[model samples]
Target: MEGEEVGIRHQTDGGQKTTYGATGSRPSSGDERTAQIAGTSDSAPVAATDDGTSGLKSAQGVPAGPSTSYSDAVGLSSRRKKAIFLCLALNSTFVMICIAVLLPFFPQQAAKKDPSDSGDVQGASAIGFIFSITPLAQFFGALFVGRIIPKTGPKMVLMIGGVLVAGVISLFGFVNDIDDWADFLVICYALRFVQGIAGAMNITATFAVLVGLFPNNVSLVAGTIRAFNGVGFAAGPVMAGALYDAGGFTLPFLVHGGIMFAGTIWLFFTLPGDAEVGTGKKGNKMFKDSFTIPWSFVWCMTMFICGTTIGMLDPNLSPFLEDEFGLSATEIGLVYLVFAGTVAASAPVTGYLGDRYINPNKLQPPSMLVLCLGLVLLGPWAETNLTSKLWRSIISLVLVSIGFSSGITLATPGILNAMHKAGYEDTLELHSNLGGTVTALWAAGLTIGPTVGTTVVSAIGFPKTNAIFSIPVLCVATLGLAVGAAYALKDLYYRQRTGTYSLERQRLLPSKDQSTAM
Candidate 1:
């Protein structure tokens, strides 16, 4: 141990020689003097000499990497970041899977339990409402979760949500009569609402930590996580179907609920401390005072229009498949599995492109253009009653769904970059736990889309209603493309006019991790 001393020597730019010294003893030895010398030799520690390392840890207690001050909470290594991603990805998968697994059982259970129910009760519309309501609750819940998460903490929120989902789902198993069913439904719906709120919070917290841990690769990480989201979507209904057939209605819900419950326990026990707290008053102030639309109203309006379009399309797809092809509930669930499945599949590739090749803002137009084509294909199919026509339409709609999902996936990165370019970081807290706010905005559009689409379809019939709805999609696509093009032209014009894009100097330094890697 006496011969293990390590001293590092370097020459300063000032033409002076300097020697950096550290004992070779591992920080774990609890030697205070050795840690002080080694830790301060590199990055500045977060706490000053007074507050930091109160115990005077030895070199053996110090880590070989950066100091504690430099390390993020949970000590996110690149490896741990990957772990976080996997956990979050599993979280996404589990949530969607839980929702999907119940679809197959619901119809058969409904029919067997109540033969006196009307066609409306048997209709996919009721299921659609059940499906739509949770997301609808999520939309509203996102607006407030930013304030709530910090107060309650992510672990608590996840735990509560998981318990609620489990309890409500278990309750679904015990209801013996139709008279008490309304109460069961209400409890389930309320729990779903709570789940939405917690989901939004968890997503934001997890993403924020990842961003901090891997700032440069945020988009790539997001894309990768989204790819897993597809896996969940694809796997959910299949598992649900298998379980429902083999185990019965009660089993699937209980099993799915149990998985969620397990994930909640994992978070409570394993989630790193000091990763992030919550979106606080400062975040609220930043949003209120600094958040702005980079392209005037263009981006906001585009999201609003697209959100509605997709929301309507998502909810109605089940019914559409049923009415068009005379498909059963199981068949309709398969269709949803395909549609969402496609979206999940394409997210990673599109996200990769958005992060690496294309400028983020530039991603909007191409995605939107493709989505418009997909919507157009859906129009004629809306009126077709032939089973073959329905299958063909399903194929075409899958194509469209892929395009639209790609567009939706691309929008987040694009908006983020646009905001960054416009210097809205301080105000929006865009890189922090403000993901819920962004999600909320998108959800608002979705909420409007379904309400309007449903109302219009009810009034005018699906075919005519779709034809009218297509107009907004096209217009929004056109406007979004135009705005993106304008930004490109403006950047070009500025380069031509001046040697530099702007006279402003760069103040922010790259992070130490990135800097050292470079």
Candidate 2:
């Protein structure tokens, strides 16, 4: 199926202002016109004259209008941004809840349906396949979906993906009803693949819309979405266990799927249409452009490493806990809750730092260092059989959770800012394509993590496997720090050689209008 991306933004050239994407642009007939887009509560439209200057006055004489092909209206209010944030947050929460609900029961579910008397290795492999397939499908979905978004629009893609996800997950509740083990495995794999595709489509569209609506708050919006996703992750397993105990496997799927379905329906009725941009020919070129962007590559690599670290635990953690501590499914779910809860609590704070206090580029290396440290600790922590493994596991999970959440929460905003600094136009198509690329790399990492983690653990055991995985994360962190230091030194050297800074130079530089209009 073809998936599309969409977003909304206003662009002005002199006195003429145009809103792009699903909201069609039109030239203003009057000398002054006010345009209002959805997701804002501002009653006063941001007024602009035909000469492309803001009507509002600044302290420093008439400040130069924001220099770009398009810029967010100075008058665009915060109320609208908050409204859009809530929608994205709820959507994120629902999506994660669906994913996490089944995690705690994977081993038991696989064994219950396996006809053959396979050993633990075989069971672990089976679990890996089950968990990894979704991300694998998502990888492909994200790679190709950007090409489709301009044609269909992001709203359609979001709604369609949401519906498909709900339907497929609901079907999961029926997997146990099948008689043959082969048939059951087939059904499970098929559902997961479809679910992954749906997830990719939904996420890509949602982010595209958010960027379109509120470009200034990219980090804040990203953080809020992740925060809710963490909340869903924290809540899903607990709710699943409770429901499973109350009814069976059927109840959890039905309940989770129903909640998602309801949210999807609400989004359909309430969410504003994303403004579609560019023809298919222009969009094709934009897709090509996405690959050419240098920061896109950096962001993708960062995503891949982060994803691998997070996903490494998926297949192995439950089985490892069960073997070492003899924990039940509920207990395993509770262990996961620690990680998810930490993420839920920390993401907004990390996001705020990225958006306001810290430069995202500067934040990345330290975040990765924390992740590496957590991974290193896992080996020794797991071997601490002398004390309660539970406490050790909790401590390890908390450390890892903070690192993982900080890394992910910072990534989108950092990359987006980098792209902006590099002189890329903040267009809907570009944002959508970049979003796809990031998601694709992340999915690829998630796919690799489990497949590799399971194989390594099966061969060498968890401690050695974990210690080995920490190497790549450490390598990535070191590279990021080196690059950041190089950039800082370059900037410093330029400042010392020149009497004035580069930013001051650019600001003092005369505009094209200064010569042409004169």
**All-Cα superposition RMSD per candidate:** 9.4, 8.0
lDDT of 2 by residue, 286-386 (tens): 44544455444455567788898777787788888888789997788788877888888888888877765566777788887888777766645345453
Instruction: Please write out the lDDT profile of model 1 over residues 1-518, one tens digit for every residue.
Output: 35564332111123211122223423344323333243332332222132111122223343322222211322335676566667767876787676566565665564443335556534444434555676676667666665555444444555565566556555555443444545545655665566566556555555544555554555676766666766775787788888878977677777877888787677666555432232354556434532465542445555566677777776566676677678897777677767777777777777777665665456666666666666656646335443336656677677666666665555555555555544443211344435555566667776677878887877876656556766776776677677767756776777788865532112122335545665
How close is every model to the real structure, measured as TM-score? 0.73, 0.80
The true-versus-predicted C-alpha distance at residue 301 of model 2, in Å, is 1.7
Per-residue error at 145 for model 1, in Å? Answer: 1.4
At residue 392, what lDDT does model 1 achieve? 61
Error of 1 at 397 (Å): 2.1
Note the Cα lDDT for every prediction shown. 0.56, 0.68
Best by lDDT: 2
lDDT of 1: 0.56
Please count the clashing residue pairs in each candidate, in the order shown.
16, 12
Clashes of 1: 16
